[model samples]
Target: MSSSTQHLLVATAALGAVAWLVGVAVITIGIARARNAGDPDATVARARRMRTVTLALTVPGAILVAAAGGWYVLGRDLSIDPNWWIGTALATWLVTTFGSTFGRARQLSLAADRAGEHGTDDEDAQWRIRRVDLIARGELLLLVVAVVVVVLQPTAPL
Candidate 1:
């Protein structure tokens, strides 16, 4: 790849990473608000909004990662064999984007329904929120690992 193309790819990946991190922060804040709020409906609403934003950020980030990986393999004249880190990063992003985001969104939707039908303090709503929160924590951890791996770009034999 030309140096300019490589630099552009790097800049795109960096911007995506920053956006992902900001999404994570938003999610964390939403989770905290949900935990502290006395009104379950409000909590569910906040969570739903936050999850939507998180998914929005995730899509572009995943695209950027995939683009960078493609560039490394095709434009950089590098063998795919040495790009395991990119693969790992992409896999983690897939998990976070599809698995965690969709899963949590479903749970939050259920919680919202329960809150509307039953009550703000409904047991079902609370249970669903707890499950979504657990998933969010796992997603955050996976995101951290993905970011570290991408930044390091380990090229050692696997």
Candidate 2:
């Protein structure tokens, strides 16, 4: 790859990494606040906002990462066997995106149902909060793995 292309890839990857880190931090803070909040409605609102911000960061970041990686791979000579790292990174990204989306939808639906019923019981609310936290943590882990794979450019024998 040309020096310019290499620099571009690095820059894009760095931005994506920063975004991922920020998203993780936001989710973590939201989780903490939700756990301590007295009102379920407030907790759900905060969580929804946080989830939206996290998704905003994640989708563009994933796109940039994928584009940079794809460019790097395609720019190389075709005679070479494809590296497994790219596939792994792509799969991780897909898993993170899909898993988070599904989890968020479920959490929101449950929260809405709880709100409509005006239930005071903390048991169900706590369970939903924990579920959201687990989902965010899982996504964060996958994002970290994907970043490492892309940045380190590790390879496996084809």
Reference-based TM-score of each model:
0.78, 0.72
lDDT (Cα, 0-100) at 108 in candidate 1 = 68
Best model number under lDDT: 1
lDDT of 1 by residue, 44-158 (tens): 7786786687568755665675676566557766554667876787678778777775455566677877878998678888777777777777877888888888778788454
Clashing pairs in 2: none
Against the reference, the lDDT scores of all candidates come to 0.72, 0.68
Listed per candidate, the RMSD to the true structure in angstroms reads 3.1, 3.9
lDDT per residue, candidate 2, 1-158, as tens digits? 89898788768867876776677668767876766776766676666676576557756666676677667667764223366677777688678767773356456557546655665345676567667778778778777777777667656433
The collision pairs in model 1 are: none
Which candidate ranks first by TM-score, i.e. highest? Answer: 1
